[model samples]
Target: MSVYQVLERWGIKNYRVIDKKAIEEITLGASILATGGGGDPEIGLLWTLGTLARGKDVVLIHPEDIPDEVVGASVGCLGAPIVLTEKPPSQNVLEKAFKQLSSYLNKDLEVVIPFECGGVNSTVAYAIAGELGIPVVDVDGMNRAFPELHQTSWVANGSHASPAVSVDDRGNMTIIDTKEDNIRAETIARSAAMAYGGISWKASYPLTGKEIKEKSILYSQSIAWEIGKAVKKARESHRDPIEEVMKKLKETREVDSFRVFNGKIVDIDRDFGGEATKGFSSGRIRMEGIGKYKNQIAEIDFQNEWLRLKVDGETLCLPPDLIAILDNETGEPIRTDIMKYGYRGSILLIPAQERMRTKRGLEIFGPSYFGYEEEYVPVEKIVSKKGCQK
Candidate 1:
């Protein structure tokens, strides 16, 4: 079939092709925006590139352009990132999930909306788009990645992840339909993942094009690509990638970002153990401050995404905000699943998208939601209180 025929059949008037080079840039930026969570970038990159190599065209469309009746679902890997590496997925993981969900929903799915811009989910969504011969929506649930399934704009805005289907490589299948209780859905899904040996693929948060627009975060794909492009351009010019990230924020959103600390990873207490830590990686990182913030200690916490940042014992950033640990010079993200001891990186913090700071969002993804016994504070306010540039 011709490309024109494909577009006409899908009623897509505006879209962009996901070429090889574009995927690379998108992967880089997505990983950085993942905020220390989102699993491994390499795994996602290889899968996406493989899809492209097979002569399948992955197309992306604007959310607004999608007709109200088109069927959409949020799809991606669901498990511990560290565990996923140990148990690599079979080619049919997501496809099987799609089939199961389609059977359950009794609708032919057309588009896959990403849950967030992450090292893994972003590309996996595109790979599924290619496999299913559908266009991937450019919008997402969380602008940045979060730990739990319910930590998304979709659920916060009255969408439910229930009627969710999870499938594993071992052929395990479980359907979740908690009926307006998305947290219960997440708990059940995470349990299914752990029981299936730590990595499973899922399809859920089923919505129409109209529900997606009402529930999901907006313009996430382009934002991630732009962030990645800025970092790549800076690298080619032999400039600091951190500054390039700041430049993009200023140019695009007028949002200020900051270099919270420059340091070498001295210790990371990544909680690796029994039921408490199963299906999720949670812990604290201690970085020995260097360069301008020399002779001081900087610390941060994580549960998928970086939750907090403290500089010399002062709380500098909080959840809903983002803390990205990047290779200070190369501008590459250092992920939670792969960071090594003694790795040198700069901790950069970006404010959460305005949509994520809404009352429901803050209540669900805020510090209190993460078990932090403190009021939610914006990164800008926290930075200014510390006498840092806003």
Candidate 2:
């Protein structure tokens, strides 16, 4: 069915038709919410922009509007963000991955879903939809950014990311469906990325429209658009954008908003640098936390996404939640690549949604996954006890 018919069926009249300008704004907002973990937006944006320039229309459709029998999947780049920054993706990487996977399954896909609502992944899904003349679902696996492959509602509800296809800029491809485990799928994909010069193209979670409606986080694109709009408004009025974000998200918790040091990065410690860590990008960050927080210290450890936050040995935040270090002046988020010891930025902490706190969710992305012996503590509680949350 046509995308218009689907939208009509769902009674969703507020959906935004993504033109070039809207795409830019959405990508910027996604990068900020990514909390220093989603792959570079420039690559994803440029790819989508190029497709539009070629006269292709990238249409977004509500999940419920889709036909129950239509097959759908998500397409994006996976591997280290650092690697993606250094090596650009080939123009046809996602298409190649999709084609190979479909050929392997002897099935044709009718729609595309964004795996996460971040810069690269979000726009990449739309680009694929545009290229293939398929409708792009307005939902995703994770409403927010996450690190691991299986750290999504799809996996939490028992759906698999298997039968995934990975491709490289050089046109080399690898399909991994033999391993049913999500971590093992990630491991194999990571190794393929290493072999393909650190970044690998991927198409995963092949499912039907009915399965997507049941398992996916619907209307996530609308959420990102609303968050982006609120931030921009706050900036124009000289209001606190973070506060505005919290208010819009209905998040009542408060956390310390640390000040930026000197606005320049001085050092970064990337763990597992020699590939012994099995495709994981582990690292620690130390910043001066200057300005109002000047002379204070801010230390953060990350395994994919920011895992822990501390200031002079006092715990500020932990995993299964979100912590972001952003530019104090522009309110732009500072990623790991741009993060330095002398870099000046504000630190913001937010709690993870309840969807990510279920028993299965915790077991997949809890503190234990990161080698921490302590039990998982919700960010709200930690901040509340410290009086950060009022």
Candidate 1 lDDT over residue span 211-272, tens digit each: 98887777788888898999999999999898898888777667999887889989999964
Cα-based RMSD of candidate 2: 3.2
RMSD per prediction, one decimal?
1.5, 3.2
Most TM-score-accurate candidate: 1
Q: lDDT for every model?
A: 0.85, 0.74
Candidate 1 overall lDDT versus native: 0.85
User: Which structure among the candidates has the greatest lDDT?
Assistant: 1
| lDDT of each residue in 295-333, candidate 2, tens digit only | 667678876567788776777777777777766556677
Clashing pairs for predicted structure model 2, backbone only: 260-345, 261-344, 263-344, 264-342, 264-343, 265-340, 266-341, 266-342, 267-341
Residue ranges of candidate 2 with Cα displaced over 4 Å:
1-15, 251-267, 271-274, 291-295
